[model samples]
Target chain A: MLCSDSDLPAPPQEALDALCLRGARLLSGPVWAAAEVALAAPVVEAVALQGGRIEVFLRTPAAPDEALCGVLEDSADLEAALNVLWSGIDAILPEDTARTADATRRGP
Target chain B: MGDLDRLNSKLAKLKGKDDGQIRASATDSIVSALLTEIEETILPREMILTNESGNRFVLVVAGRRLLALSGHGAEEEGSEGREDAAARIIAVFRGPFRTFLDNAREISIDAARPPNRIDPTMIGCSVETLTAALVGPGQASVADPVAAACDLAVAGLRLVGGDVVGRSGDAAHLARLEQFAGVGGAGLGQLAGDDTDAPCCVFLSDAGREDAILARIAFRGAAALILAPPEARAELIALCREPIPAAG
Candidate 1:
């Protein structure tokens, strides 16, 4: 469930689980079947994998020469992957309003 | 399995105890005492204070967490002594209190500014009876002291009535931790620049668990704690006051 724009409580663990499940559905066939939880402070996101392949990529796909392909695989290995995505998004693009856009594009 | 079970157990415990098991007043006294101890023992600096709707606040350095000082005042008491009490409390923050003071600068900005919109120093929630209130009416005995302190800091932030704020680097949280840690400004800035280890720092506010969660992310560490109940905060601060060497 989406946290309301107003006040919110800690994301219920169930909600986090549901988020993971939803993320798993977005990737194509033969994708890794599980989700790993990651935290980005007030927000939490998941990283999806298929076999050994990591699915995260930058929103502004760089030209072959201009792109900065950060280490997405180990970006947030210990915690959730969405948090890592958010931080990268924030650093590359500090616009606060783009949080949802960044989160949606990079979701599992 | 143990980690999974622990997570499950913690989630299960969150099910009940929703009567807002926090005694607003009791929490206030404890936070007040902890700040008193910090002033008396740690860093003694002068304080700038203001009050609105019965809550009180003291401004510190530019980037430090706004310290909230509370006390159980005598209702039957007259105003003549209240000023003196305020003076004593202000005095508590004075004298050789360290660089937390040196970093002070007048931003000349109102408390309503964008970042200050979520005032870091304000104890956003009531602390009076947090112990009796949070641990469930029947299970106060089982309240984990560490959890309770973290609860108090979060509660303090919320009580002051601010939005839940979090970011890659929470400027105020970083500033306050630096000041509280007594690290020089340049040194503290450099430490913040070092993203090698998970950062950890305690927050004191009137907000609730949300703030604690924010602190946890802000200070990514194995044991990131946010203490709210004054007694709980005191214990955590005591631990923080320990000598973990920079070399070790």
Candidate 2:
């Protein structure tokens, strides 16, 4: 359930819940979430959720000096935004032995 | 002498020297000459990014580094103004090229990090794809997809005298771009002969080394060469003034 009062609309609450769930799913895997994740892997540096809108701050290792922003109106738009973020992370992540091992264990 | 004439003479003089020596000499002369021209032609006001605090950051796109001013401020504290500021900044920078954000409010700015570096892929596409993604579907302003793509890629780069070369569809050539993964400028030379159909973009980092490097890649049919510091625009334009004869 989204961390909102009972008065909030269902669609927006559902969308926020989905976004958090997605973040949680990523955490369940090899990835971990923290402000420090910006130090290494691409991570969500900041997020703003309010009034049925979701905004994400993405810092990528490829260009550490910059952050990319993505906004989603509701749960319907969350997947596309997530896809953009994940694609960028994949682009920068090293394709080395350890990464390969982790990915292999994670499976498709 | 005319700019092209002077450049030709310089190239002629570099003919007999070692390949590295000639390239270094040519690059230096070109950069020196162009810096003067850039200052006189392009106004500084045109490049300034005017927002709230007037903070400047380095934006690197397609290998070119540009000084971008912060146009939005996270005023009012909390997250209320943060994402809006980021969206405004991105919209301002990308607006000139007709790129639009689907959900500007969904974007957030990581104020904790210095806003200098920009990874082109962060938007989930190559510089090329980002350009296309921003375009609204059924837009009548864009008639030719290939030309539009090339224009999009070049526009994304904050280059002064930069121009796209080779094929415009190169941006759509993803298989070729994959080869550049994890490789910086050092490993770029190895990509010379890999795929004839593949297209790539170039940006000159240093003055001395770039002449030879640019020449070599130009010979290999790279898509574009962006002169950095914006001061090198004059020289880069002159060096690339004539179409390089494709490698035999």
The top-ranked prediction according to lDDT is 2
What's the lDDT for residue B33 in model 1?
A: 32
Cα lDDT of model 2 by residue, A1-108, tens digit: 234435645557566665555443322222222211211223333333323334454544334433445444422233345456656654444466337635665887
Model 2 ranges with Cα > 4 A deviation: A11-17, A26-28, A31-42, A46-108, B1-248
Q: What TM-score does prediction 1 earn? A: 0.19
Query: Candidate 2, clashing residue pairs?
Result: A55-B106, A65-B117, A70-B106, A70-B107, A71-B106, A71-B107, B51-B71
Over the stretch B1-248, how does candidate 2's per-residue lDDT look in tens digits?
Answer: 75435534543443223432212223333223322322232222112211223343222222222223233331222134434433433344444211111212111111222334544433211322323323335432232222222333322211112232333223423222222221222232332222332222222222122221121122222333211222333233223222122234
Position B88, candidate 1: lDDT: 33
DockQ of each candidate's interface versus the true one? 0.03, 0.01
Worst 10 residues of 1 chain B by lDDT: B104-113
Looking at candidate 2 chain B, the ten consecutive residues that score lowest on lDDT are B100-109
Worst 10 residues of 1 chain A by lDDT: A31-40
What TM-score does chain A of model 2 get?
0.37
- With candidate 2 superimposed using the best TM-score fit, by how many Å does residue B126's alpha carbon deviate from the native? 32
